[model samples]
Target: MNGVHAENLGARKAKATRWGTAFLVATAISVLFLVILVLSIVSQSFGYVLVISEVDTASLARNGVALESQEAPALIETLKEGLTRRHLATLEEAKPLESRNREELLSLVMMEIVQERPARTWTLVQSVFQRKAIFDFRDSDFPDGRLYFRSWLRASLLANPQSSSALDSGLRGAAIGSLATILLTLLIAFPLGVAAAIWLEEYAADNAVNRFIQLNIYNLSGVPSIIYGMLGLAVFVRYLEPLTSGVLFGAAEKGAASGRTILSASLTLALLVLPVIIINSQEALRAIPQSLRKAGLALGATKWQTIWHHVLPASADRILTGTVLAISRALGETAPLVVVGASTFLTIDPVSPFSRFTTLPIQIYQWTSRPQGEFKNLAAAAILVLLVLLLTLNATAIILRNRFSARRRTNT
Candidate 1:
């Protein structure tokens, strides 16, 4: 009997060890997958492209006169002299060189004067592993073309406006629009969500009506975000057109007839994230010690004063964590904004809440839909930018949370 019992116990221990190993293997696999995904995106964002120019740089830089050293007027003259009449006319029609500053003229000289266009592109892996193949292919197919490895995510890519051409396109307008929309969303959602959470968790009676309201809030958090977009379209875009379009404020631009603007998008995203913020904040408020609230009331403080001075300060960090989650969800959301009429091809930055706009997600979707290979690389680069923006926003929120937490500790 002792021998049989000992063998059974040994078998059970071996089984438990197998399960632990399996769990660790699963976690490692998940981490490996994430690493591969990020590396793939980075690889696509940098590489070698076979670029051919309408005019050679060496030809333009003859007589020891480099194009970069020239003044605005001289750069304009050089551009005109180097570029064909048709190309020069196109550049002038796009934006007058005469009105542009020295920096702008220099960029135009490099871009338009040289007229660089990608003939063929290679991913980072191909550029690094098959450098000889890339150069040979460029030399054989297009002798005039140059094979250069370039990082697509340059400062100019963030500075310049969107263009039809992949080489000339940038994220300035989309980035600005994203920031404006997110700011508006936060302004609208955070206070309202937090206030609702405080009332529900601290002040509201545990009655049937309040319980029903809590249930609905939980349900809303699970509803599809695109449904919120549709709701925003029906309400903010149509019913509140005059308000959202800035017509009521007398700030509407001429010919800007539609209510499909950044304000509507922001409001739509706010609605989408409101339930998340409220639920998370309720949990945070509930997490505060009941003893602290009792102590404030024991000191002859009213319920409102107790909450404002004690409970809120204690729960500020967790409340900010909810805000961070809400912002993250809103940042990556494209469907709701799309339904509320985000532009896929906006070139101009949004001047106000009522202006037409596009976010980075919309920009990435637009680029990925294109047939061009280069645009896919651009889309990958845009994804990286979107990730960076989300991280920056979360980092800022975390810093604020930590500051409040420190203050609370010092006060206590």
Candidate 2:
């Protein structure tokens, strides 16, 4: 009997070792892929561009003098010389070109008068390794164009709005739309999901109706997001146009009757992530030991009181963890928002939930689908922004969850 037990113990140890090795190998592979993905994205977010102007700066420079070295008055005169009367009027409409400082005037001269555009581009890797070759190519093929390094990802990109020109475009509107959508999605979904879970887990009887509801929620959680988008189209956009479009509140845009608004998109995403939230919240509630509830009741506390005071606090961290997952999905979702009428090129920031909106993911998709190489680089930069936003949101939730767990432990 002792010999047989020793052999069995050895076999179990071997199995455990295999499983441990497999787990480590899987984790390493996941981390490796994630690093590679991030590196690949960063690679495309910056590079060198041959920015040639329609009116070459070389000519504007006069006898090999750099245009940039010229005084503000000279630059202003250059602009007056180069720009049309209509162009001068348009520039004056924004700000008096005569009153503008040197730097501003210089930029205006290059971008507006000179009409500097990306003549050719090179990736960061190529820009670094083939620096001489790239310079030679630019000198030979596009001698008039200036070769300069440009980082697509810029702080200005966050502040500026989308534009027809890729150089002038930014993710400000999309980022705002995304922030508003996620905030609304969390507001609408979290309470409803937690309430539903609380009722199902704590109050509902063990019967077919409840079981069916639970099973359906699990199934719904796995449904394609696009289906939810279609559902939103039919239900929110079409049937309940007044509310989603904010007409019910006496606020509506010109085409809001179609119900394609930020509120509608948020509602659609809320619906998309609702089941996941419900199921995960239910799981969290289920994991709470019955003894806590029984002890609270045994101390003469009401059922609602017991749950509000004890059960919820016990499961708060896990509920929040699940919420992180749900919101992550919501933040990254594009299809549903597209179906619900997200504008691809919204230049202005969303004024309200009723206004037209677009998210980073939609912006990325639109830019990526374009034929322009610069837009592709912009798309890559947007992807990085989206990833950072998602990570920041997730980290905030995790920090909150950790604090809850710590407080609960300290209280105990």
Worst 10 residues of 2 by lDDT: 56-65
Mind giving the per-residue lDDT tens digits that candidate 1 earns over 264-294? 9989999989999999999989999999999
Off by over 4 Å in 1: 1-16, 55-69, 77-99, 109-114
**Model 2 alpha-carbon miss at residue 356, Å:** 0.8
How many angstroms is residue 58 displaced in model 2 relative to the true structure, after the best TM-score fit? Answer: 7.6
- Model 1: residue 187 alpha-carbon error in angstroms: 0.4
- TM-score winner: 1
Error of 2 at 270 (Å): 0.6
Q: How many steric clashes between backbone atoms does each model show? A: 0, 0
